[model samples]
Target: MDDSKGKFGFFADARRLRSFLRQSWRSADASMRRGAVVMWCVGLMFTIFGVVGDVLETWWSSMPFLTNLLTSLTAFFFAVPVALLVLHDVSHRMTDRAGRRAAMAVLAQSMYRLEASVSALGPVEHSRHSPTGGPPLTTGSILEAARARFGRLQDLEGGNAEDIREATETLRTAIAQWKLDRLPDQFIEEVGRVDIEIARLRDAVRPRFLQSDLEWPLDRQLHSLAEMANDLIKRPEQWTIESYNEWCDVAERFSQDFDQKSEITLLEINAVFDLLRHVQAMHIRRTTFVQALHDFNLSARTALWELSSL
Candidate 1:
């Protein structure tokens, strides 16, 4: 913190400060930087005229008016431009720097927020249910986890190094996964209720006024979709991202094809089309949201990998 300089330190510090300011201004816009040059030129002009007027006072004792005119010109330039230059630099450039700092701060906060949100979507470092386990925790934590998991000394079952390592890793993952607290149980219950309602509706959703032409095909697609939905009810764990994508594709295509080929414009059949349209909208929204998540997830992963490599 000490800023006190030794002998000859004033010149050294001044040169260093000047160099720092020079480097800082190098990145400034060319047009904006011309202001500094103009200010320097104005000040230089005033200095030159002031020195000439003083020298002329000695040479032209009879021409005092001419000498005084040069002095007056020097003062005139200083009185106007010097004050304006100082005011402009302080008011404009300082304000610009402050504004940029504020904008950059907000931008940085937004980027951090996006990063955190994306990172949260990835698997937890330690989760019992997560297929991808996290990195190692503390020193000898893996060994401690294996020790905690052991039922009895005989349960070791003459394990090889690979088996021991695998068992240790599984326990460690569980221990680490504890970091993530479960969301409220009410949300889980609500999700289950919604799934049941969806299955029930899907099961009952079929067109009564089916013709052999386009209606039959639409009916078949609807039945297939219902089956897929019911399967998820039975085993939600069986579904993957690809499975959801395929489901969305099937639902979207069914909706589109029905719109194109469906000639049934009867008052009663209008209700069916309305229901299908609503379902189509829901599917479209879900598909869009899922796709955005997928794209962002991929981009985040690529960015992380590249950064880690560096």
Candidate 2:
């Protein structure tokens, strides 16, 4: 006997091939290995039924059709379960992918809204500190006050679109009233226009899963800016030439760097000087919110990747 050959030479290579295939099967992932075993068992059952049916056909010539029908039914029964399993797995994967994609899109869109709102400030000046060299416009006290007003958004998990919209509308009214009291000559008209724009944006806000991921943070930043501005406005004591110069410093910092449209006018340049401090103070909070949003997006992507792997 040759070491490589069996009793028959033809069996040698075929035996090695079977050994190799078994090794390959053992190397597969646990779930896939189980699936392969199940399918192999089903295939073996079908093959056995076919052989048995053919053997029976020789014994009963008049009933050969019955055996043939049994053989076909065996294949059908086995195929139905495999097909259904495949369809179910495919549907589950698709639904999972779609859900992750929708969540990511909603988060991105909410970030976009905040980005646009921030850009609406145009260019901010370098000096973000207070004019008298005290605390900045967005002082800790001012932020605490803003947070007091927005309890839900400051600590939100989830909310319906209508309820969030209503809350934002109420916030808008409060900010508008504060503006009327402080900068009545400028912000009275400006607040109305801002309200109209805000209404349009709010109405356009659609329902989304994980929507609070964006809404709460973005609203928090906006409210903080509003509160800071109102706080600055209330200080008639600081309305000195130095404060005016600090406002000028920030307002004059704007150039055609990013946006083409200029919201600042020579007539309201004085008002813009006053408005500039709020935007300047908002820079820190804006950066904080943006970093938070970035982390959120990263987490969402990681979840999506994990889902894909599964």
Candidate 3:
């Protein structure tokens, strides 16, 4: 089937040209279409005027005015419209191509950054990805993985290394199953890998990304996370004995300075609030990733690798 699609000859070239013109004409601005209509009318008028002027010139053989009028009409209508049309068409095409390239570049960058956020989700793979070199994961699998990991997280007693490890692995498994279209399988597939895939997606749509949905959200999120660091410090990635002692010392000092009841309440409330915010942010990022993929209009079954010739 793919081979057949690749076959191209005179008829194929003609078909492609027809398709291009048809799509371009359909997508063209109304003013441009109107201008095309005006150009066609001008050409027809030029022909008609030249014919009538020739008859008048013949009738008044000695009159230079009739001949000059015909010549001027031909030049004014023919040369001017043709030049304007050429410039308009070329400029539109250049603008269109530039817009598409920029959009693809944005997409490539988003995919790169989004992949980094996915690490928090564990080893989820796109439907086309096989992280372990085993098999491609699917969307269903990733969604399930997210569910199960959330469950595991809830079940944890003390957020011990073992519990976090199991939950993390489960998270990975579900994601590996998710098969986001070749994600976890090769997330390092940034810029270089994603660029090729973005190029493919852009080419498939004829690079018509006149505008993009991905404005500055990626940057905004990163900056927000950096600035909001103090908002959550419930469970650091690692809790050393020294840090535990320090925390205990701080609690003792606070209790000595003030009522221990309020200090304890404050600590509990702060941790819970921080944890809630962190969880909320994580889930939001997940949905954002999913939404971004959906907005890209990527085929459900088309994995990044399968979609493009990397």
Better of 1 and 3 by lDDT: 3
Candidate with top lDDT is: 3
lDDT of 3 at 73: 70
Error of 1 at 185 (Å): 13
What TM-score, to 2 decimals, does candidate 1 have?
A: 0.28
Q: Candidate 1: where are CA atoms >4 Å away?
A: 1-69, 78-96, 115-126, 129-310
Off by over 4 Å in 3: 1-24, 56-72, 75-90, 110-310
* TM-score for candidate 3, residues paired by index: 0.34
Q: Model 2, which residues run further than 4 Å from truth?
A: 1-61, 122-125, 128-310
**Per-residue alpha-carbon lDDT of model 2 for 158-220, expressed as tens digits?**
234443444334333323323322322232233233344334333433233334232223344
Please estimate how well model 3 matches the true structure, expressed as its whole-model Cα lDDT: 0.45
Model 3 Cα shift for residue 23 (angstroms): 4.3
- Measured against the true structure, the TM-scores of the candidates, in listed sequence, are 0.28, 0.34, 0.34
Q: Can you rank all candidates by lDDT, best first?
A: 3, 2, 1
TM-score of 2: 0.34
Candidate 3 lDDT score at position 276: 33
Per-candidate Cα lDDT values, in order, are 0.41, 0.44, 0.45
Candidate 1, residue 106: the lDDT equals: 38
Error of 2 at 144 (Å): 20
